[model samples]
Target: MDRLSNLPNHILSDILSFVPFKEAAKTSTLSKHWHHQWQSTRNLDFNHLYFANRDSNGDVQLQPQIFIDFVQQFIANNNSPIMDKLSLTFSQPGDFQETVEKCITFSVDRKVKHLKLDFSDPTWDENDLDGLAHPMFDLPQSFYNHQVLESVTLFSCKFDVFGFKNFGLLKSISLGWIELKVSTVKALLANCACLESLSVKSCWDMDSLSVCGKDLKLSSLVVEKCHFLDPSFEIEAPNLNYMKYCGTVVLFTVNGTSLEEADLDFGPEFECDESLGDSLYQSLNGICPTRALTVCTYMLQVIPMGEEPTGMEPRLNVTHLTLRTAMHNYEQGGIRFFLNSCPRLETLTIDIDRSRRICNEYRPPFEDKFEDLWRSSAIIFRCITQTLRKVEIKGFKGTPNEVYVMLYLVNHARVMEKLTVITSSEESNNRGPETFRSIAEQVYGFRKGSENLAIEIV
Candidate 1:
C-alpha cells in the first residue's frame, strides 16, 4: 500500500494548492498513482526562490539552468491541463524574458484560471528608454479567450501588447507598481466585461485613467500612490460597490452612480478646477448618501484651504467622520470653518494641533482679552442641528486651547455619547501616569454631556 495514496483527494489537492506547480509535478515520481495526481492539481505556484542566491549587496541571482529545467520538466511531466491558481515570482537579476514568456505561454495553453506575476528579476534593462515598446510576453490570439480567469496580478511587467481581450473571463486584476499606457488600461476594462474588482498601486504616469464597460460589474476599485494622470478619468461602471484612493490626487470626474463606499485622500495644495472636494461630497450624496465618510486633509493657514467648497444641499447623513487637521495659526476659525461643512456627522475623530487660545481661559480686566477672540470663533457657533454620538481624540495633549475645543464639543453636541481621549508618549506629560490620570479627570470638568465619556491615556 502506498503511504501517499492513503491521503484523501481533497487533502492532497489542498496540499498541491500550496506547493509550486513544478514541485507538485515532481511529486508524481513518488508512485505511478501519483503521476496523474500531480497533473490533476488545480493550483500552480512557480517560484524561483529554490533556485536563487543573494550576493554581498543583497542582489538576487537565480540559477537559470535549474529554473529552466524545472519549467521544461514540469510542463512535459504534467500531462493533463489542470492549472487553476498560478503565482510566479522571479527574484533574480537579468532578463528571463524568453523563460518568462514561455511560462506564461504554458499557463495560457493550460487555461490557468488565475495568474499572479511578480517580476522582480533585476535583469530587465531597456536597451533604450524610448525603444519601441513590445509586450514582454505574448499569448495565443484566442488564448484563455473563453476560459474564466478569476484573478490576475501583474507587478512590474510590460503590458503594452496583450491584455484583457485575451482573457474575457477575468474577474479581478491587480496592477501593482506597473507602468502601462491609457490605451492598455482601457483595453483591459473593455475586454473583461465581467470584471468585478480592480486595484492599482504605485503605478506612475496615469492620471487620466478611464474605465468603460457595458455589462461591467466592478465591486471594488482601489488606486493608491499612483501619480501624474489627468484627474478627470471617466469611470462609467454602474455596479461599483467600494472605491478607495490613497496618497494620489485626482482632479477627474467619476460617473459611478451606484458607488457605495469611497475613501479619498487629499491635501491643501490639491486644487481642483471642477472643485473635486465639492464634486466628491455631492457625488457621495447622490449615491450612498448615508454612507460613512473618512476624509484627511492638512490645514493650510487659519483658514482650511482647498477649493472653496460649493454649497451642498443638506440631504445626506454621515455615519463616521475623521478629521486630521493642520493649524497654520492657532486660530479656532480654521476648525470652525472645517466643521461647518459636516452638519449631519454622527461620529467624530479629530487629531488637532492648534495654538489658538480657548475662551474659558480668558482672564478679566483685559490681561487675557485675547481669549475672547478664540471663544467667539466658529466652534462655539450654535449651528449644529443633528445629534453627535461619539468623539475620539487621538494625540490629545493638555493644552488650554485643545481642552477648549473639547469643551466646545462637549457643550454643543446635543446627544454626545462618548469622548475617548488617547494621548501619545510624545505629548509632554510632566507627571507621567499621574499627569495623564489628572488630565483625563479634568477633560470634561468644564463641559457637560451624556456622562459616559471615556478617556484612555496611552
Candidate 2:
C-alpha cells in the first residue's frame, strides 16, 4: 500500500516541507524511498528539548552531545543550496558553544532568510527580586553581516552592536530577555533601513528609548516590561500603523498620524497618582489619531484624573474601542470619559477581568444607582444616538449593576443594530436552564431604541 512513497521527488519534497523537521526525519525510517527525501527540506528547526532523553523514573536528562551529533549528521547529508529558515533552541550549551557557533555559520553560508536563536533557561525565575543572572549565548560575527536575512528573533543572547553591517534587506527583528544599551538599539535601528516591525521585551540596562526617523518604513512597534527603562519614551515614525506598549506609566511623545490600532496596558500592579495620571493623559492625547484602541482597567481609572490640554477638545478619532476592566466602581468615570470623547464610535466591547474580580475586596462598590451615575447630565453623547451600531458585553453575571447598565444602553443607543451578551462560565455552571430562560425572557421584554435591534445571549 505505500502508494504515497511512490510520488515524484519534487512532490515528496513539497509534502515534507509542511511537516516539522523532527517528524519529517522520521519518514526516512518508513521506507527506502523516503530516506533521501527529507534532506531536500528548505527549513530546519532543532530544539534541545525535543531530543531530551528520559530516565527510568521519567525525569528528563538533557543530552547536548546527542543533539549536536544529530545536527551535524543532518548538515552532512543535506544538499540544499538555499535555506528558507534555520532555528536553534537550547538552554545549556556548556562546553559545546563552539558547535553552536558552527551551526550559525553553516546557516549563514547557506543564505538562510529567517533565523531564530533561543537560549533561554526555562527554570530561571523571571519574578525573583534578587535577579539571578541569565544564561549567556553570544552570537557569532557571521550572523551580523548577512544581506539575505529578512527576519531575525533572538532571546537570551549577547552580540556586539558595533559589529553590525549593512542589513539592507531586513524587514523584522525581535529581541527578548536580553540586556541592551540605548546606543546599541539606536545603532541597530539605523542600520536596518527596510525594517517594518520591531519588538523588544523584558530587556534591561536602558534608561530611555527614542525611535525617530523621517524616512523609516517601520509600521509596527511593540515594547513591553523593560523594567530598567526610564519614564521617557519617544517615537516619530510616520508610517507606523500599529503599536502595543505594556508597562508602568511613562511620558510618551508619539507622532505617527497613520496609526490604525493601538493597545496600551499599564500592568495590573499600577497605582494611579496625580503625576502619573497626567503622564498617561499626555500619552493618550498623542495617540488620539488611532482608529481602533484597547485600554486596561488602570488606564480607565487614571485618565479621568488627568487634566485636559489647553484649548484642545480632548476628542479622539477612534471608531472601535475595547475596554479591559474588572468592572469596579472606580472604572465607571473612565468609561464615561471615553464615551464622551469618542463621538464617532461605531462598536464597543467590554471584557471583564476575571482574575481580579474576587481579589478586589479593598475597592468599594458603587453607592449611586448605575443609571443615575451614567446619565447624571442632560448632555447626550453623540455616539449613543447617531453613531454606535453594535455593542458586546462579555463576562455577564446578571448582577444588579450589570442589568442596570444593559437596560440603560438598550434605551439610549438609537442606531444600535445588535446586542450580544456573553455569560461567564461560572454563571452558566451555577445556574439552571430555567434561570437562563427567565433571563432571556427579561432581555426580550426590554424596550429597544432601534426597531430592527437583534439580541443574542450565550
- TM-score of each prediction: 0.63, 0.83
In order, candidate lDDTs are: 0.59, 0.77
Residues 110-187 of candidate 2 have per-residue lDDT tens digits of 899999998887666544412868767878787786779999989898887665556668899898778767787788
Give the per-residue lDDT digits (tens) of candidate 1, residues 147-222: 6678888776655344456566678889865565678777777677778899986666674677767577888888
Candidate 2 residue pairs in clash (backbone atoms < 3 Å): none
Poorest 10 consecutive residues of model 2 by lDDT?
Answer: 357-366
lDDT of 2 at 49: 89
Model 1: how far is 2 from its true place, Å? 22
